[model samples]
Target: MAAPLFLLAPPRSYTSLINAMLGQHPQAFGLPELCLFNVPLLKDLWIRASDEMSNEAKTRQGILRAVAEIYGGEQTAATVKMAQHWCAARQELSTGLVYQEIVERLHPLVAVEKSPSYTISLERMQAIRAAFPDARYLHLIRHPVGQCKSVMALNEGAFALYVNAIEFLEDRAIIEPQIAWHDLNINILNFLAEVPPELQMRVRGEDIMENPREHLAAICRWAGLRDDDEAVEDMMHPERSPFACFGPINALFGNDPNFLSGPTFRPHKVKFPSLTKPVPWRDDNQGLKPEVLALAHEFGYQ
Candidate 1:
């Protein structure tokens, strides 16, 4: 298998678009959020065993979509069944083992993926490393203010609560999403510290979206993949990726359902917010807390 490339970021950080874009590269196969590490057994992905919150279903969409494309050459109910059988064949294998098998099948082309859920646990990432010690990682970051606002906007901070993402569940009972935003980013940074510099690259998501051609070329160069104009143009068409459109009914997505429904890339410059000012999401006049500011600076925001 080619060296696995992971896109690391907290949820709602534009990881979906970025991952799709990178996968669209001619020499890369961008897989959906396989989310295999969430479980030890591959069968657990198909059995909806819990009445409570379990994201196991997240595994199906990616696999189904991949099967539809790689094996069946189309995403239809028949192809979805084919995907089921493919997964069933690997039911006894560990998630990483199954994933590596897929990667191996796509050999000579790098496999690109981003499972936002992976950032929830340091152990999940460790499991990825344990499987493929030579895997490469892209530590993608967004400004805390932007990341927090996006997270809260989606399901009222449900993402935050799900990950127990907050750094400090404070006595003040303030809904400080910056706490989760800062800490999860810190989790990625701290975990990545042990990885060799050659195996990792950090890119600001805002930069990629705003100046995709330039940034994509930089990333391609870093990954040691082709950085020619044709390759860059192909990466720009992330919407062309099989998983970019509607997924099979059995597995709609490991990405944003909305994104799947209408995945298109448009160029626009992202405005960086001021760290010293009150954010629009917060009702009070209070600005970003000192700790949040520090974290923003760490990500190279002033």
Candidate 2:
């Protein structure tokens, strides 16, 4: 079995675009956010959760679309139904096994994937290492201010609420976004410590967006894939990924819903926000939390 590549980050990072681009590499197979780790059982994915928000449901869309395209050769309702059965047949297997099966099916091409939810817990990441001890891990980082802003923009920060993405929960009960940024990133940092440096790497999302061709070539090199002009050309068309657009109705998402609506990848410069400034989300121009600032410095923001 091929050693898989996993992109780890909190949600709303430029993970979708980066993962798609890397997947489009001639020697790689980018996959949708399978989100398999979120649940222990495959049926749990289809089981209606109490949250009722349907966010988890979006995770299935990628697999459905990929199955439709890779196996069924068309993304139609019927193909999506076939994808469901495909998942059903492997309902009892571990997520890592299922992913390996998919990668093997695409033989010789490296499987590239990013599932932000994997960062929610360290144990989940450990499970990945245990599954593919030789697997390569990419610890993709985004500035807290930028990441939190993007998170808040999506569904009015419903994801933060969903993940209980709170940082400083003092006895007085003041909820702070800065703390959320600091702590969540800290979670990622600490978890990454256990991963061997040889199998792991890090990249700033902003850098990739600002200088895609260069940074993408760097990423390709890191992943042991070809970084020639042809590979560079293929990476430029992330929009060409099968999951770049809306998934078939039966399996509508394994990616950002916003991306599903408009998943075009255009190269553009990204501005890094000043950490010293007050965040725009709060009614008041509240500055970042002290802890958040400390964490930002650890991530080399200072």
Candidate 3:
């Protein structure tokens, strides 16, 4: 079985675009978020991680869509139904085994994936390494301000709230996405510490957005894939990916909605906001926390 390349990052870190871009490589297979590691068993995907708004349901949609596309060779209502049955058939199997089966099916094609939820707990990440001892990891980072802003912009930082990244003020607990941003990155850093240096790499999401061709070529070289113009050009057209656009209603969201709405890749510079400035996400207009700034700097951000 081909060991896969897992992109590790928190949500809203350009994971969707980057994953799609890398997946479009001629020698690679960009899969929608499998999120398989979030659970110990294949059946657990249907179970909530907690009483709060865990992303298991939405995450299952992505896995189902991936199964539908990879197995059914199509993602239609009927295929999604088939995917449900597909998952049902393996409900008793270990999630790691199911994941390996997918990797086996896509052997020789680098399976590029990122499930931000994987960073929520070290156990999820550990399961991945245990499954693929030779797996490669990519630690993708985004500036704290930009990442937190994007997180808060979506449903008032519900993901942070779901992950218990909250701060208690005098009276109420408000979502603090900066906590999630910092802590998730830390989780990735800690996990990567145990991985062999040659088996793991890091990239800045902003740099990739600015110079996708060069950065992508670098990634291709590192992953032992083709770095020639032919493979590189294929990666540039993320919109060409099967999962780039919205799928049928039954499996519409195996990816980000913003990405699904406009899956095309535009090579433009991302004007990152200042780190110390008042963050737009907070009504109090607080700047980044010291911990957030420290991690951002460690990631080569200002």
lDDT of each: 0.82, 0.78, 0.88
Which digits, one per residue and each the tens of the lDDT, describe model 3 over residues 1-302? 77899999999999999999999998889999888898889989886644323455777888888888999998899999999999999999999999999999998898999999999988889999999999999899988888888998887788899889999988887898999998888899889989999999999999999999999999988889989999889989999888998878776787788999988889989998898899887777788889888888888887
Could you give me the TM-score of model 2 versus the true structure? 0.91
Tell me the tens digit of each residue's lDDT in model 2 across 1-302: 67889998888778888898988999888888877776666676777654424666666667777777778888899998898889889888877677677878877888888888887777777777777788888878888888888888887777677667654433434334455565556667787788788778888888888888898898878778899999998998888988888766677677887776766777777777888987777755688878877767777776
- lDDT for model 2: 0.78
Where does candidate 2 stray beyond 4 Å? 49-53, 167-176
| Candidate 1 per-residue lDDT over residues 247-277, each given as its tens digit | 6666666677667877789878888888888
Better TM-score candidate (2, 3)? 3
- What TM-score does candidate 1 get on C-alpha atoms? 0.91
| Order of quality (lDDT) | 3, 1, 2
Per-candidate TM-scores read: 0.91, 0.91, 0.96
- Model 1 residue 144 CA deviation (Å) reads 1.1
Better of 1 and 2 by lDDT: 1
> How displaced is residue 12 in candidate 2, in Å?
1.2
Candidate 1: give its CA RMSD in angstroms: 2.4
Error of 1 at 81 (Å): 1.7
